[model samples]
Structure formats: structure tokens, C-alpha cells
Target: MLWDWGYALEILPVLGQAAIITIEATLLGFAMAAVLGLVFAILRMLGPAVAWPVSMLIELVRSTPLLIQIFFLYFVLPKFGVTLDAFTAGVLALGLHYATYCAEVYRAGLENIPRGQWEASIALNLSLYTTFKDIILPQAIPPVVPPLGNYLVALFKETPLLSAIAVLELMQTAKILGSETFRYVEPITLVGALFLAMSLVSAALIRQVERALGRRFVR
Candidate 1:
């Protein structure tokens, strides 16, 4: 038969396990990206003294292919005695690769705050940390939620790339199923459907957050 219901049913449990790994990697990698990106943005905004090196680091990561980064992390780093397992290496690559993009998003958000806000903070003799934490990030982060949400979805999709390093994500599970059964349709289609469903759910959640933030921003 072209597609076997029995095979599909048998594979569901396997695929479900893989999906959990995918979700875990996505959430962890995105958390790293979010935090690291904020740090990068803050350092760049500190002054030209720090900005130039940070800017170059961001550019280097942005210019490289994520696959290369993954391979380097998984394969090459062990040569230097900095070894990581497949999942950790893949997650780190995803986090660091997307961090450059997240940094730009943060930079734009921080820049969007009016110059007057900075001047007022300085005039008040506020500490730099207080100005950023109390005055800056609150205003900057709200407007950037949609963009960051987009990145979250993007990073989730990118999890499949982890399979290159033997992470056994959804797509990898599907591929293994296909190889074992000598049939591709059921496993591949199931993987695609699961991805679509998750993407839609993420987009909906993002919209809800955006609306909530919009209300709060206006208030």
C-alpha cells in the first residue's frame, strides 16, 4: 500500500518522543538567545570602547552558516578539550546563531526609546543599571515582542537541523522511521503536520501576548 495506517499508528509513539526533544531544545535555545542578546545589546550601547569588539563578534556569528557552527561545536571543540554532546552542541549553536539576530532586535528596541529619556535619566543622576532596568527595558521590550516571537518560531523550525549532529529531533526520528520501514510518506507527513500545528499554536500565542502588551503599553 502507498501509505499504511498500521505503520503510522506504530510510529506515533516514537514521533511523540522526538517532538518532546524538539520542544525542549527550542525553549532552552531561545532562552539563551534572549538573555545573551540582551547582554550583547547592552554592551554595544555602553560606548565605542566596548561596542566595536561586540559588534564584530555579532557580525562574525551572523555571517557564518549555522550548520558550520553546529559542526564546529560538535566536532572541532572536542579537539580543544571543550567537548559537548550532540543535543547540547546543537542547542548552543542554535542559541548563538540566532543571538546575533536577537541582538539587532534589542538594539532597535533600545534605540527606539526617545533621546529625552536617556537625558532625563542622566540628569537625575541615576545609575546606568537603574536607567536600563527601570527606565529602558520596560519600554523597549514591549514593542519588540512580535519580532521576538517570530524568532521563537523560527528557532523552533531550526531544531530539525540538530539532527545533523545526531540529536534525534522530530525530523531525525521521521528519517529513521523511513529507513527502517523502507517507507517515507507516513513518517515524513506526520512530522510535517506536527510542525505545522506547533507553528500555528506558537503564532497564536504570540498574537495573544502582543495584544496583552499593547493594552498594557497604552495604559
Candidate 2:
């Protein structure tokens, strides 16, 4: 097999295209996680009567492998006549799986808020929703920014698992290119480099966010 560097260069555009899909999936999935995770976190905080099962569910999902969850959605859902396209399945699976971790992240964030804040909200007789909307979240979110960014980075890497369900992400595209050219080394190398580039770029952006949010938070 000829190790043609130019062949890898030619496929750069194709890899870029697939990277976009991976980024879209990561962003959308993390957005889903942020919202749903907050809900679960709030549910857990309110009381065990409502919270216990929610906590159990979150822990259960967290304990199990995300890959298994993806496989279950792709394979088992069909048995019940619920069919999903590969992209949708990949997005939903990734979203649901990561939501568990995000819930814990949010929960930790909420807990970090001082008891005085909660007490003050109660003293002000603010409704729970009002208290959270006006006070708790505004304060909690900034400190969590760094960790949340880390999760985003983690989610970016996990996109390759989508390939198991046939979503054509970066690694998947590399696999196809490799098979076609019978040159796994070049294609796979390019994929790894692409992933590393993305991760480094994301981390840098997150650091900027951390600094900006940190200043506002301290004010």
C-alpha cells in the first residue's frame, strides 16, 4: 500500500464535512443535556418523594455504558416499531446519555450555592421557580462553566460511537476512506489529527469563557 500523503490531503474536505456533523451532534446533544439535566437536578433537590426515583434513574444511566444505550436505541427500538434515522438516533442517544452526567453537574452547582441564598429566597417569600430563575441559576451557572466545557469536550470525542449506528461522523468517514484506498494509516491519522485539532480549539474557547464568566461572577 502506497502511503500517499497527498491522498490524505485530498480527503481533508471530506473529513471537514464529517467534522461538522460531529460538532452539530455534540452541540445539540449538550443543549438537550443542559435543559433536561437541570430539570432532573431540580427534581432531586425538591425532595425524595419526587427525587428518589429521579436520582435512581440518573445514577442508573450514569452507571451503564453509553455505548449500550446507543445500541439499544438503534437495535431494540425497531422491535417495538419505533424507528429512528441514524442521525436522530445518534443525537438522541448521545443527548440522553450525557444528560445523566449533566444532571449531576448541575446538582453539584446548585449545592455549591450558599444556604443563605435559599434562605433569603424563602425570607422574601419568592416562589420556587422565581427563586431559581432570579437567583440560584444566575449565580450557579458561572462556576459550572469550566466543568460544562469539559463535558462538551468529552461529548465531542464520544461522537465516534455514533458510527456504530451508521452516522457518518469523522471517524466513520475515515473508516470509509481507508476501506476504499486500503490505506488505514493515512486516513486514520488524519481523523486523529482532526479530533485533536477540534479538542484543542474547544478547550481554548472554553478557557476564554471561563475567564469572562469568572470576572462577571466575582462582580
Best by TM-score: 1
- Candidate 2 error regions (>4 Å): none
TM per model?
Answer: 0.98, 0.95
TM-score, candidate number 2 = 0.95
Model 1 regions more than 4 Å off: none
Error of 1 at 22 (Å): 0.3
Q: Model 2 clash pairs?
A: none
1-219, model 2: which lDDT tens digit per residue? 456778878998998999999999999988988788888988988877999899888888888998898888888999999998888888888888888888888988999999999999999999999999999999888888888888889988999999988899988898998889787888788889889998999999999999999888786
Error of 2 at 183 (Å): 1.0
For candidate 1, give the lDDT of residue 73.
98
Question: Per-residue lDDT for 6-106 in model 1, tens only?
Answer: 98999999999999999999999999999999999999998999999999999999998999999999999999999999999999999998888999999
